[model samples]
Target: MSKQSEDLLPLWTLSTTETELPLSLTEPMTPSRLTELRAVLAALAESPIATLEAHPLSAPADTSKGISLGRMSPLAQELATLAAQSTRSVPKAAGNSGEVLYRMVVPAKVAAEVSGGVLEPMISKAVPGGVRSALVGTNGISAHASFVPATAGAAGGSAATVGVAAAGAGALTVAAPLVLLAVAAGASAHADHKRQLEIEKITALLEKLHEDRLDDERNRLDGCRSAIDKATAILLDKGKIGLSLGLDTAVHTIDTALASAQRRITDWRAALEKLPPDKVELRQLNDAIAGIESPGSEFYVHLELAELAIALKRRVIVLQAVEHAQQDDGNPFESFTNSINLDAQNLEKIVTGLRDVLLRLSTLQLDRSHGMRDFTFSSGAVDKLLNTSHRLRALGDRVEAGRSQSDVAIEMVQKVDGSIVVLPAMAAE
Candidate 1:
């Protein structure tokens, strides 16, 4: 796998280089073997050096009866492959070819379980309360600590700190106490440096992810604003033909609201640029980002209101046409009445849904400390559009009622001379 793929996978280097597999891994796939593996993993989860030392696998060193790589399960096969790769990569001393190296690739589910259950808790316990909060609280960013162990020679030569001869019983070779202390200090320093590098890597990844999300939100906002502008322009054109009713005032309100929202977004972008390189400042930034209006909510509401305005404007035009047609003699008014009634019904439904959206907006819990109010729609603009819808609906109702009453009073009649006359229904009767 590529380096990126390896980083995504949960991989561990085995503590020992053994060509023959341990019974825990080589044993037949059973519940017992699974239990044993889990136990071993739990023990090794904290250490950079993953070893079966002092465990049950330490005994039974006979390699002759061990299972071959082909006979193992898929999981074991992968582990064996990794082990072979490790053995080949590590440098070997002369005449010490018996030493082997191993690595293991754990399943994703098991990795997550171990990370959350074992690793995170261990980290939480190890760090100070303040540092822990800075690392994992409210920011929605998690720290995944990875450790790389110091390499050991292929021979049973001493590892980084100590060396043992392979031919003899493993006897302790103690260096001077001062020398041991110096080695311990150097290792500690190296561990700290490695940890710092890992932290930087994780931080960079999270920053890129956050930037991508922000870019998407900005694009959506721009699209919505463009839609609202187009709709407003169409409405203004329609108004020029003498059908306008309080349109300029409503449009002005919408423009003002949109401008305010745009300014707020610009301010947020600026804030992102000027963030100080301090822990507390970063945490505050995270909180502010979280408080941002849910992606596109601010502009989406305005876009909906703009659509409703255009639809209502069209209905008003229809009403004017109907009035002009009514001035002529004996024109059928049934279609006009039905059309007006339908418009009224549809307008009511649209207005109700818009009102519901406004209600939801009002209920959003924006943090005033973060200046989130500027990112929301203006109340004045929303109210004006809603009130206009109500007026249009009322106008439609009056037109429909007047036309129906007029129809009832007029009747078409054919007299003895065979000429048709339209007169009051009472006179015709």
Candidate 2:
């Protein structure tokens, strides 16, 4: 066999970010409570073969994960634990046995509805005389125990993903009515008044995440606008250096700057929607931004400009990432030639990643209301229905893509000495 060259570029790739959180840090289940819960679990196991039972779908109790039953029913607050705990469409691996984890990350307001209408409706009463609500809840009963997973950071290194082996399974498949079934099956007269101060507190810190992301997008947009202003001002004084490539340098610069501003706004709004309402910032910023709409253009010219701006930003981020990677001990640069940029290996990875990003951008361009395959499904009320629908759909791998770190290409500026110039050191793909 012929010998192969040792020079091959590595790909730049970003790890998948964590999209879930723990519910709590404190253990709600006391030692006495755990003993009591174990008793209940035993009871359910020993229940008659024909008896029906159900455990509240809430996560099991643990000090590490901070998820607990807390005498609060799953119906009361769908997000008492992590909001990202919704049912995964992907089936569990074969032959896996343990708690089958389910997540329900409802919006704060919507969670209120679920709590009031389903979870803790019967536990409290405005009037002490009523037994009807208790009667309904008495038909089925569930006992939930809470547990916390270890802090996510201490569990994982560098990357955000929790250790897969440590993340326990969700609720088990039982043959009987279980704890929830028993709660519904029968109730004491005191059951209606028992620990009546039930309030389902969501442990999902989504609002913090949302506001942070919104600020991030907004800051990025502001940065783009600032860059354009500075660049435009500098160019007005220096004037265009006649490239004679049939493209006006000044006009294109302006176009690129404007494009960056628009893209930032788009990103900001999307991030805002992803966050919980409680975590959003004060209305003061909202009032400041009110009616101050960002530029909107339907023309392909604006679109091209925006694309250019994104490419510019991508290029910059890539280089910055490279600088950071150079410090990484894991970098495989030792095997590569010194003539090549240290991060040339990572370049291919970023370029590949950009494909997924381009698809997202494309979807945003194609459908403002529904991105990708998301479509309006409600009958008459289109806006409400489409907006309310759960965003549980996991984007497929093929739909995702990336770009090489340096793939955001600009027109090559040919120099007298024959070296081609790559402008905009840090540009987006």
Best model number under lDDT: 1
Please, what is the whole-model Cα lDDT of each candidate in the order they appear?
0.28, 0.24
* Per-residue accuracy of model 2 over 1-429 as CA lDDT, tens digit each: 112122111100111122222111123232233234333433333221111111121222222211122223221222112112212211120002222222211122211211111122122321221111111232232222222221212212321111122233212212111111111111111111111211000112222233354334333333443343333222222233233432234334534554454554454345444534332222221232332111121222223233334333332322223223234333312111121234333333433443333343223211123336546544544443233221101212223233222111111111222222111111111
User: What's model 2's lDDT at 156?
Assistant: 25
Predict model 2's lDDT versus the native: 0.24
Regions of candidate 2 where Cα sits further than 4 Å from its true position = 1-255, 262-274, 277-305, 311-378, 382-384, 387-429
The stretch of ten residues in a row with the least summed lDDT in candidate 2 is: 7-16
lDDT of 1 by residue, 156-265 (tens): 34433112122222211121111111111222222222223333443344344455543443333323333332333332222222323443443344344344444444
